[model samples]
Target: MNRTAPRPSSLACDECRKKHLKCDSTTPPCTRCTNESLLCSYTPSRRGYRRRKTPWDSAKTAAAQKTPQHGGTSTSSFVLGDMDLNQSLPLKPGDTTPPAPSGSGIVPSDAAVFSAEAPTDTPQTIATNRSVELTRQEEERLVHLYYTHFHATAPILVPRKRYATQAYPAHLKAVVHFIGSHYTPAFDSNLLHDAVEVLLSPPQESTLHTTQALLLLSIAQHARAYHVNALATLSRATEMAIELQLHSRDAPVRYGGLDPLLQESVKRTWWEVYCIEGYLAAVHRQPSFRCNSVSLEALLPCEENAYRDGLEEPQSITLDQYDARFFADHSVAFSSACYRIEAIRILARVLALTAATVDGPDDIQSVDNAIVAWKLHLPDDKATAIDRCGDVDQMMLQAFAFMHTATVFLHFPRSELLLRVPTATDIECASAMVPASPTSAQHATKAIVASKELSDLAALPVNKYSPVFTCALVFGCIVQLSACSAHAHSCIVQHRDRVALMTGALKSLRRHWPVAGQALRKLNTIASGIFNPAQSKQSGTSSPTTHDSGIGMDATMGDLCWFDLFPPRNGTEDFTMFGTAHDIWPS
Candidate 1:
């Protein structure tokens, strides 16, 4: 066999360039490449790549918008005060209407050219608006606060600069103000929500803005003690997302020429829908969402910082790459958002397995494998859930929270982990004599260890992450409380204290999040059934705190309406959660 002769070239071969090896500068094959039978070739030099620069006009715009506020967040320059009064019609879900005015508000509206003070959260409010009853300035502040706190963690919305300068229809702005006002002390989100909802016309078109807005509203609705409404909103968002083809691999290309940020936003929006719907399924105790499976083909999001900086990955990694990396030699540094997506997807599967109609062993085993693989495949930076700056990775922590919760849900039935009272999770108990899948001691240990780890995550300041974590804390507490009840040994007291930690975390979250408030009430009831120190010790007649009684939950009751375990809050406003609706709390 005649080998292709080595020929001189101007640069190193591709493989040599990658390895930083000195190449003989050859065509066909370099000397070393020929000896090793390597494909030796070179092309363009990858030099002079620098951080993308903001154009002078954009820079000037950004500079003017960068004025600092409390919490070190910069105000964005979105001119929303003078939007044109054109026939801005809002679209209700499944309705047939055109839409509210659609444009980046930097230059907007047929009736008004509204511009407000750049977004700031310093207890300052500005005035200007036509349809929605929020001032341009208040909208600015709430939107800015949402970007600073919520977006940094979840990141579904546009960048802070882009959001302030450019955004969508009035109803979309309304959904934003609805959530963002929860972070702002000076405004009433409820009134804002009503005002925003009133703008809805009969639904007609399903644009990206409408899809994005519904996603935000669904979770916000859940936060406001409306799980049914949240479920409905999520259903609509899921449908709209599919209608937008957000679940397809080529979804981004389907949109005409979106800039990098918008392209990234397209992917982010779909993943957000999948993750949020998973949360809703767990909260609602329903079947897994169709979106979770539908979005499997789409590429996972790029790095969190890259998305923030408006740099799209030339070739994003697929879920297949993420799953294959565990056995493959090379690895990929997945973004926090990607890991979050994977975690929630598995969580959905875990929930589905627990709710399975068929008594199949393969399903549970497969889900368990996926859960373990998720942890084993976590890259170095993500393993610890903290960054080099010592800041907690909220999204990564959320991913871990989902994974840990999955373990508890998957094994809570088979592991023999005790439960004090009936939890929001309905368990189908296996007979002690002949279990279908024998309850492994390993499974029980995983439940307790997972419970402890969950408490640690709950230790994060409530503001650092989404209030949706309210469900995870409740799940962890159920296991911790059960352990506390099952064992009176000195060791069990630690589990009892962990129960307090989880409960306290929910209480802290409840101040702003109604779902957490409900969870707190439900947890106290569970505690009462388990080993209520106040009730048990004071009454001097303790309930059995052992394996026999603690583990004997009724299998026929099915899943509880997780949030409705306790009755309504009786129109009571928690004082700790409110000094006044408008009192500014710490960021």
Candidate 2:
């Protein structure tokens, strides 16, 4: 009988055997042979498969072959491996053996098993897909958590215990992380407002230390928003800081380590609070609201009470001495605070000017002088002192300059200043009086010319500084400048003679724009209707009016003329110089 010769028992690796290739029976599968579709063989018995001597092994195999209890094809063997034979199988009682492969009726050795019976798809592939899906779901969950936790309501309320125990710390950390890592100019303003409100709200006696710290941080951020009420928020934060300091003295110091960054951040917040309080007090007309001498003194560090030689000596001091020695110790914190305060002050002055509330030429001149003095004291380099006095010094100088320019504009009108173009003789006289220092001379000349022009403009009915009118004028100027550089250049050239004669005026005026934008918005709200000249009847006539002997119509035109020199920028179209113009206009 010509029977088919028994198929040679191939000793291929399980992978190769499954592909139906010939076996080489090597220790490891041969890469070349596998690539060529030949059997990348191994001694199957010596590989992963071992002889099963235990009853557990037999039962595990049987269990693996049975339909899975979870209602799917059996895949447990692939995941669990040949644990039973190894005596490491964590099997329950009554487990069954896996079925032997069909046709051959020969149970494949563990090495021959290659992979567990795949369930329509590979586990690795399924795991990869599951991981991807899980990650996407996690991201969506985080976003939902953020919105629900932070932005769902105007003022979210938590149970006092819950807030103290959990919510405060979590939210504060979230906000800090967000501010530290993901700050952008476009976040919702209400987020900051709500955060401030929550932080400032009185805490219960049971509030956690962590909660208090977070509240302080939130308050600090709120104060830094540069909004109309930011100063108020900062003031409250300072009070809380004092409370924290007192609280810390009694509490055990438990932070894992002293974080210099966190310390610096806290100090900065305190400094800002002090500065805003000081500046607001200095500028506001209301006596009750003004910062007092005691407050100002408090803003400075307490004098060290060290005993000297036989006599207790009162040290001779310069402003620099106070800044360098006393304030210097807290320079980083104090200076950051000072910068914010000065920035706000400068902005406020600028708004006052844009609103045309400045009283007279003298007022404008005084502000100019203050700016010059402050500028003289400014440090020329990056402020690195411990107290960072240099930064505050610079901010003060800049603030002074901004205020000076604003005062001049507020007190004067534009058209009158333009008409008072300086004569050749006037320019010569002004140039001859220039100071020896190049920087001083440049600044002085700019200031003088700007002041003179502003004074001249103040004399014109068209140059009136009513809040509404000023807003329109400033916005119009910004828009005009922004739209056409040629127009700006022409305006500058036309007023060059007057600008040159005033000495240091143009430079000073130009420097104030950034600061002035803030003030302009405030004033616009104060005098909204006045900005629209078309909306209001002419005060008397559009014609420029002559003033006292010292101030001519030309002089007034010179003052007003400063407004016409610069054009607005392309992206600044949305910025109305007098955003608050409607507020102050007669009802």
Q: In order, what lDDT does every prediction score? A: 0.59, 0.29
Q: Tens digits of per-residue lDDT for model 2 on 1-587?
A: 89897653434465544454444545565554756775543422311111223455345546655633211112232111221111111011111112222321112121112122332133221110100011223323433433333221111122222222122222243343233211223333234333323322222122223333333343333223222233333333344444444123222122102422222223333333333343333222111122222223222211111110111322222224434533354332223223333433444443333334323445445555644443344443322211233222223332332344443333223222222222212332323222233243233335344444343332232211111112223322322221121123345433333323221222222221222333333323222221222332233212222221111122212222222221111111222331222122111
Best of the candidates, lDDT: 1
Candidate 1: regions farther than 4 A off:
1-132, 200-204, 256-258, 293-295, 312-315, 418-437, 528-587
lDDT per residue for candidate 1 within 40-131, as digits (tens), equals: 76544322101122353346445655554211223333232222211221222212112222221111011112112212222232111323
The number of clashing residue pairs in each candidate reads 22, 68
Q: After superposition, how far is residue 363 of candidate 2 from its true place, in Å?
A: 11
Native RMSD of candidate 2 (Å): 28.3
Weakest ten-residue segment in model 2 by summed lDDT: 125-134
Show model 2 residue runs off by greater than 4 Å: 1-200, 203-235, 238-266, 278-370, 382-587
